[model samples]
Target: MSIVLSDQDKSTLRAAAYGAVSLMAAATGSPQKAATNAAIALRSATGLVGHVLAANAKDIELKGKTVAELADRVLPALTAAMKLLGEQAPAEAGNFHGTILLAIEAAQIHPDKANAIAAEMARKITAALDAGVAPAAAAAGPDRPELQKAIEEIVDSGFVGVSLRVHDERGEWVGSAGTAELGGAAKPPTNGHHRIGSNTKTFTATLVLQLVAEGRFGLDDPVVKHLPEFGLDERITVRMLLQHTSGVFNFTGEVYEDGTIAPGIPIPYGTTGQEWLDNRFKTYRPQELVELALAKPARFEPGTGWSYSNTNYVLARLLIEKVTGCSYAEEMQRLILGPLGLSGTVVPDASPELPEPHAHAYYRHGDTTVDVTRQNPSWTSTGGDMISTTQDLHTFISALLGGKLLPAPLLTEMCTPHPTGIPNMDYGLGVFVVTTDGGGTVISHNGAAVGHAALMYSTPDGRKTLTAALNCVDDANLTIGAAFQNAQQRLVNEVFGGGQADPA
Candidate 1:
């Protein structure tokens, strides 16, 4: 299926695509160099998209005295370009979209300081691209209005935007409520990408378990055997790390049950407001993050108690790298993402690249609110630094539970629960096992990273699931934490037949 674009269409596409780079350059105040790099990235595209973008830009007029004026023309043009490409050549629609994002990335200057500005621009550009097509799905007519109400209530409860996907007996329903950005009218893209926060633990744990199944290492092997350089406790085993029974201090601060706080690195919550914003782009190596936690006293002797810690996952990530002689991201691709065909998922590592068509996330510092969507996630590492779409999450969880990614026995062990001091909801190797109100079980894990959050849940058999992404206005005080919890409970109760307690 070849796409034959009329000359006018090509002109519009070229102008829109190149004008996006101009917008990025304007945001960073580096027009000349940014334009040069962006042009190279744009022309680097292959196939039909390459030929179209490689065409001379001399005839195109990117008219605007100001960035706003330019965006007025370029944004609509971007949408029109996507609409025509999607209708005429759907595959090229993706290619065209990727090329534009690459150019935008190449156009950045001093991204550490310009991140919020550049991210806002990128969000606008992505929104325009997404606007070219209809939403992936919506709630209408007589089907699952309660489901729709759940997400709308999430927004009404102070979330900026929400996109939800459900797969059950009635087939799949995808819907979104609220605006993509503050003070904007566009709804969040139903299938957009998001930072899944600690949900990365499920993926990391699944990878470790898969390696264990293959005899690369035993689950009960001492963690020091794989990586003696860390001088980890000999009692800490691979199983303990995955199960969060390692008692390692969480690198991203901790809150005791007594309401006391132990601060580690500055993240987007607690007393980290101004400090976190100042160091938002600072990159922390996985080892550095783990070492920071190691410097703190252990919360309990290895295997003595259960506590959620980011360092455990960081150690797991390092173990995977040590055993496989590959980076965590590489093994993840080979074992999980590639096999599952999860094209929209990524282990960002130290990269702050949140892909296109995502709703904006924000953080408030007293009187000021800033877009925190583009901060470097290296601080969290494999603990919570992955990006994925709701569709990919549903696929991953369902497939993993459906016996596609692991052996049946190993999967059973993975889902086997350990008491996490929370009643009715127990911790598995890397997931939460909940006793639903109907006496059935649900396997789940949900996580939040500052202003962005994700909810991932599924029935025991994986026959039903609810996955969602949320964007909100966050504060150091965590004013939105209660709403986040209620939103999770509301959705789980409505979708999974009730009785979900204290999601992780």
Candidate 2:
């Protein structure tokens, strides 16, 4: 049933809007004097949302006006601003709507009909006011078209969506491209969380080092020394596991240099891709995953060669548990996520959910595009099953390299790289040390899960960083490997080529 509002309801709604505007403006800086702040804010809001004002305004003459009159006059522009932001990022549109609706509840306008108009007006006013933000924030914002083009190129290369965040001396710039879901237009949230994949290895390795620093074990100690129940090889030292020198088989399956495959778990992107899709939500313990790999032959003798083995990380997970009598998730929070204030991160165990406001990941299951955003990541365990946002990744990597997480010597030791047979490419404990044509070495770790991926990179000094998340249609064949690699190189060159971050 439609309802109408009376004059008294309008007056109360106006009063509430005035109060909220004054309160919100103070949050930006002016706490002690809201009225003085409100006067300053109303002027700023009109200037910032001037395009909206210009579009919505009629023949009403322009002149200096009181705060109440300006608020009433700009209500239409506010609604338009919210609509624009909603259209720009659909994932956050619902939250914006909820915020606007909540603003009216404090008014306590009686009768459902009166409440409806109040809510609508409140939403419009709140949105328009929010668009005003602060002049300093707007000035500090990163809108470099060149970086924007880089992300656009990534999405244009057949990915569904890509959300990127770059923290550099140029300041923090975030951008996204493509649809939040297939067959839609809204961009992914730049701060949205996605599967961090093997980036979890970096976090797990950090935990191991932290334990070592606590005198729990030495990096050179044998794996079996702590995890004796697993019967790991005597030569497979803790360093081997962190450095991919353990020679253990990758439980997700491993590819030999000659291209033959040794199968382990039926995880995504493996030869058993269809089987993995069928059992995506099935849970497996870390030990169970490690056992599957143990049943297979080792890739090489301990410390002889390097291979990306998920099993090494699963063993690390159990090692963490066995050594500390705590789950990997709890320890990670205690040592890293919680300490760094990364509230968006989740150490999900046997969980198939991505936190809200995330781009949905898709996979090609024969002819249909399947939504694989939610799946029991226990299959990958500590090797690849963590979820985080670009912001959190940036915070974690910056902290780690800036000497906030580990000691100077340990970080130096952690960064020491061993050639992985790929020319100029080396693997560190859980990170990659790549010598770039830019005449600099970049420390990085990137990972991909079923239909999602994360990109994390930082300078050795941690002064600059790039962290990103993407959703796309993936399959066992790794259909987008070329595009993914190209995207990586393009971004690297743009970021670190001694001021050669060209848009082209």
Winner by lDDT? 1
Q: What is the lDDT of candidate 2?
A: 0.70
Across 273-297, the per-residue lDDT of candidate 2 in tens digits comes to 7888888899999888888888888
lDDT of 1: 0.83
Candidate 2 lDDT trough over 10 residues, lowest sum: 44-53
Instruction: Locate the minimum summed-lDDT window of 10 residues in model 1.
Output: 133-142
TM-score of every model versus the real structure: 0.75, 0.74
Query: Mind giving the per-residue lDDT tens digits that candidate 1 earns over 1-504?
Result: 244888888898898898898888887776798777677667655446668888877879987799999999999999988787766554456456656765676677454464787779988998898787542122122366887888998899999999988877755566789999999999987777789999999999999999998899999999999999988999999999999999999998877889988999988776777898889889999999988999998989999999999999999999999999999999998998766656567788878778766899998998999998888999899889999878678878988998999999889999999999887889888999998788889999888887789999998788788899999999988899889889988888998778674555
Q: Count the backbone clashes (under 3 Å) in each candidate.
A: 0, 1
Model 2 alpha-carbon miss at residue 338, Å: 1.1
TM-score leader:
1
Q: Which regions of candidate 2 are displaced past 4 Å? A: 1-143, 498-504
What TM-score would candidate 1 get against the native?
Answer: 0.75
